[model samples]
Target: MNKDFNSIVKVWEAAVRKSAGPKKRANRIFSTPMSVAHVDDDVYQVEKILNNGDFYTGQWLNNFPNGHGKYLWTDGCMYVGEWQKGNITGKGRFSWPSGATYEGDFKNGFMDGKGTYIGSNGDTYKGFWVMDMKNGQGTQSYPNGDFYDGDWKKGLQNGHGRYQWKNGNHYIGQFRNGLFNGNGTLMWQNGNRYDGCWEDGFPKGNGTFRWCDGSFYVGVWSKDSKEQSGTYYPSSGSDDDPLEWDPMDLFSVDLIDCYVCGCEKVSIFPSQKNLNMFGLEEDNNNKHLLSKKVTER
Candidate 1:
């Protein structure tokens, strides 16, 4: 951080705040900087340094950085791109000392419009931004092979989007505050799928689960599908009419983490009726659905 620059900014801000009335408050967090640089009479292309050891080299107007210019800060941050009226604006590339880089549209020093950000941890996001935050459509790729393609708001995963975990588990649904909080479909790599509503990163509300072996269940669920409550229909014959009209009490089977930071695995136990109907030997994957008792992974 540049202390000199910050002090100057603070002094300038104080002046603005005292000017504005109480009703019209000036957000100190967001600032509109005003400064004048002192240069020689010959104000041609030249390199000028500020009091804070920040330097700008390129087209300058009236002692301020204007038009195309490159600015380098004392903290090892450098920006090379367009400048307007002493502010970092327009298209440019900003690089930080932490190995993070942003290349795209900028507005008054804030990342706004289309751009791509490469984080220090190798995470990359390409999308639209508003006031330095990720907004609108974008695609984010994680170093661990996790990927997200969807809508974003205030730098969080919001609205509709698709998240693909590194374990081959993918979810497509609506999100709120970076979690699976709305309707979506989670498809496990093992061919297990759940289509329903989600809340706070877990499965909740009414939904349908389809197993790989043709078994399925329809019911309301809460949190993860640990012990789900609903009706289970084992895959005996047709999808329409179940060969056995028996409803088994579904209990703890698998723990599908929907696992943001962890992994999800769900297993269904064979009901006594399913065992008798299809015979355990014949139907290897014979399990059914409903009532849930969520447990930690």
Candidate 2:
């Protein structure tokens, strides 16, 4: 009983109007004649009684629209769906005057469960909803040919998903509050690829940058820029010595030499050829000397 009945009515009225069409057109209520007949205890049927000479003939309970009903509001707003104690519930389809439409499951007068919402601006979202907000897995497509398909929480991309732009740039990975965060992979239309950890939509921490020319860099990054020195591997090396490889390169290996250690032959142990490849001569088990520039290419 602490809930304000007047406020609740106003909110419900607003929800209907907003979902129908332009807010300015629905600001005022239109008068109409209506009749009500009692069916049983606290149950009745209303006819010809709605805003703006609209029609509503349906079952009512507790003096409110309940059970199955059809309500055509003023300003061409129409809703045909199930109701529970005056609130839209279950399956329904609501159409606005501007050609916007929503068809899906509802609960407590709010869009919940699976549904599709097509906006007048040519944007569309088809996914799980909660309280009229995108809340779960869904796909949103923009008018500009860009689209996002992934997990959502409270209308924001808050989990793993993929977004592709019209220009051919795309990102796939974890997200937090609609921004790229944690691990992800981004690919440019020009054939550049970045695989690494991200923070605030920029590549950060350890990552790899593979250029279109076959040269690649593996190392730490700060705000998407290479920090300090990193290991560079040329696609075509003429050096007779074995090339140095990053530990992460083995992650994409399809075969491994050892079952117990899961280490591939190229990464498990470095040979004397490997030491000479990096211009390094081992001084001890943990250190070495740089004999020359290993990456002259």
The lDDT of each candidate is 0.62, 0.61
Candidate 1 displacement at residue 285 in angstroms = 92
Tell me, by TM-score, which candidate is best: 1
Q: Pick the candidate with the highest lDDT.
A: 1
- List, residue by residue over 1-297, the lDDT tens digit for candidate 2: 224734654454555565543223222222323344567886665554334334455676754567777765544566778877656778888766566778899876667899988877777889999877789899988777778899999878889999887777788899887777899887777776778887766657888877677777787766323353357677665343334444334332311210111101111100111111112122454342212233311
Any runs in candidate 2 off by more than 4 Å, and if so which? Answer: 1-45, 51-55, 224-229, 237-297
TM-score of each: 0.66, 0.63
Checking candidate 2 for backbone clashes, the offending pairs are: none
What are the candidates' C-alpha RMSDs?
Answer: 24.3, 27.7
